[model samples]
Target chain A: MLPIATIVFREFLEIALIISLVMAATQGLQGRIKIIMLGLGIGFLGAAIIAFFTDTLAASVEGTGQDIFNAGVLFVAVGFLSWTVIWMKHHAKHLSQRIHKVGSEIVAGETSIWVLVTIVALASLREGAEIVLFTYGMMASGQVTWSDVFTGASLGAVGGTVVGVLLYLGLLRAARRHLFAVTSWLLVLLTAGMAAHGASYLIAAGVLPDLVPQMWNTSHLISGESLMGEILGVLIGYTPHPSGMEVLFYVTVVVLIALLMYRPWHSKAVVAQK
Target chain B: MRFSFPMLSLSLLLGMMTLAPMAGAEEPTYTLEIKDHTFSPETLTVPADTPWTLIIKNHDKTPEEFESTELSREKIIPGGGQVRIKMGALKTGTYPFMGEFNPDKAKGQVIVK
Candidate 1:
């Protein structure tokens, strides 16, 4: 049950991002739909391949080994994705203008529309790939139902599409400015939590000894595997009591990355105006 | 502090190989006796990368399941019978085997030297 909830939450976030991007390309950019769909199909294929491999590899390494690998992957991915999100928010206006200029310049060249189509398609595909990896990570943890993940993903995509369409139609203009900001911060939190989760798994595998055994006892309330913890676990990488290094990994990574992003584009109006 | 990369790997590899008694290329045959629901000589030493057969003679009255998640293999043997587990030149590590029915009493460790 807890696993189901976890799947739903992760899928919701992933689908929301995908829908937002698709809508942004179609309505916002006044781009061709056929090209975008083509890109999505390609992305789906790539995602399927990645999902298959990640599943097989994860199965080969369970308990301790599985946990360490998951944590490492999550750390790197979160770092990369967070960086990309921050970059996009800071430069979206400039990027859009640049893309429009490039599009117009190459409009006279051989199939400029195809280039734009390819660009949007590739971006969407990248997002799809991330979704596959993230979903696999959640499943490998043995905490969620496949049904919950699919259902959540469907709902999230639908909701995102609606919001994206609204944004494209100029119905939800104000929301766009802060959307990336909110998502970026949430990602920071999630990644930090993942670090701790990874540490715990390593401890379980005996790869790393419990330097500080029982960071804090939560058996009285909700054990680590409880439904509540599972939900929190997926949402923010929650741990009942974390070790010193685990806490350090969580706090330092999230806070440091957030700090790096906050300084340059902290002002909503400034970024939105650009 | 200034150890060359290849040299470092060689040293570690050599150390591990020496530490693991069953890690030798030469295959060795041994008998594991299970009497009174306990594995005799709980620790079996063998060289790594050496193919070996684990002959389990269960002289107990009940059944026992020899399970190893790491090895991805499990075999069940009934009372008054013997079973064979083929360790095909196993990797250099301790492969833990347990009896599903009597886990506490039916515990044993396979050490790859």
Candidate 2:
């Protein structure tokens, strides 16, 4: 078996390299020192907080506590995801507009390098934190090994780096611009699944007792402990036998997000300024 | 100026009167003990509607930290020493806790039974 420590180190190195590439692409060589430092600082801080919390939670809920923790985490994850989707729906367009505006300024100014650096730093920090948190959750779930996580993370970094480079070269600028939407939707899908899984955990704990708890049992199709199951679990929070709460959580999250998307409340502060 | 001075004095008096009850308020106490990598007496049964002062004693030689997810509370207790926890009325159910710094030999439970 591979050492978990080695795998984590490799993952960190991969992320660092990806950030470096993004820096090279967006900021060039003129003036990116401060922005680069800020990005690194944010990324590391986010990772450390996530790691510490995950470890603490894992240790606390070792035995039967595990089930409780899983359910609790699942519920909270669902709530958080619902909030995120609604928030994004309302603000993402505005955010992109602001970025384009800022991009124009950077392109026009002599201190353009500094602007580019800050943009790159902010973007990387946001995405980096998400990647790290999601990876940690995957690791804690026992659906995959440290090696699997490292592998996924490394691949993601490679993919993200290539996109960053192409973006800088102007070969795939449109695709880069499309990233925010794509990643946001991806996160929504991922969170919905996590919420369902969490409800399943709670169901097992009797906290959420349900009639006809087995919503079309799929263990015969894909056991929860199998590799395919793990993949499904990570991507869409798939469970073999979901209880009523699981279904309820998943459907609720979807509905709430859909509503928010229909009539989002854009920040009044921004609109008021306009 | 004279009117303003009297108003300020009256307000100060009212503020002191309001804080008198708070000044005499007591901190909640909780009792937690660690043994065998598990928190002995895992269910820390406390009053459902009242604040608690947790006094945790780590009898084991391993360093341990007591953490609860539902409560979102954590306090590190040095081996052979003790730590204190203060909590308000928490929702009914089992709140899980564990030794974070060392998970091996210092394990136990805290049941709010």
Candidate 3:
């Protein structure tokens, strides 16, 4: 794949996966699509603003401004996404029982669709700003023509949307009976992955310690920047090489959410009743 | 007794925060200049196997991403400003990087020897 296409495609795919997960999870909910679209609109606008002053933004925070801002976006998304899972458990038919089976009480999904909206916006903003910054960079360098960047970006966006469509359809059809199961689990993994990636950017910025620099190098096998690696990177935050802190963030997110949802003591009560 | 998860995790956080990077072990900081959409000293040589800091000063009034896949690092430097990029130790080789905003003019490389 050409570098331009690969770069654009990778970023587009990251946002696509997040959007698709939310779409599938909130399936059958009223007006969720409109909310998500509104989110995309706001996110794109925010991205344009950010892109316009990327230089100013990057120069802030003792020169780690972009990293700090991006990290904040990631963390906010993490918080809201976790809330989504808990909210769904209380609001959805299957999730309530599922939570009960695990000895946890569901919160009223009354948390407003705005939580999901914020997540969608933040996720879209991160990638959208990246696209703007990258394209502008290439444009200024004059190494690539404007048409080239535009075409590459269009193709990449389409490609990402195609995969997203497939995911949503597959969930709606093949997994109709288990939509709750699949989507809820997918949300958990996706959230954890986001946490891990956020930690990595912080590590790169020297804001976080590198407990262990390289857990292993799979770059020789499948580089993280490769197309497959990029897809996996989006779907599960997979990396060819991960630092110790990234692993810690990933595992902690997964375990923490699981424990919150599982409520072991309540499960024991459920088991006794059964 | 069941461990109070909140208390335990809080303690862990405090412990790690205490072990922050020491004031010493400072590496040499290198400088790169971006003027009129171009980088000065297009070829910078640094010692191999030594981590260093790069303070990129952009003289132009436009933003550029200081990106190098080879060095596995990418950061943006705004116009008429500066940004610091910390590159880990490198093996002896030439790693090319460029201004993502002005790829045509802002070209440069880090020569590790």
TM-score against native, each model: 0.40, 0.40, 0.76
* Candidates' RMSD to native: 14.4, 14.0, 6.1
lDDT of 3 by residue, A209-268 (tens): 657656766767877656787667777777876778888999998888787666675877
| Candidate 2 C-alpha error for residue A183, in Å | 4.2
Per-residue lDDT of B41-97 in model 1, one digit per residue for the tens? 788888776566566666765445465544323444445555444445455777677
TM-score of chain A of 2: 0.49
True-vs-predicted CA distance for residue B13, candidate 3, Å:
14
DockQ of every predicted complex: 0.03, 0.03, 0.26
Output the TM-score of candidate 1.
0.40
Better of 1 and 3 by DockQ: 3
lDDT of 3 at A233: 73
Kindly report the interface RMSD of candidate 3, rounded to 1 decimal: 6.2
After the best TM-score superposition of candidate 2, give how far the Cα of residue A164 lies from its true spot, in angstroms. Answer: 15
Q: What tens digits encode model 3's per-residue C-alpha lDDT throughout B29-106?
A: 899998887888999999987767788998866566787655656677766778766556666878788876556677
lDDT of 3 at A173: 92
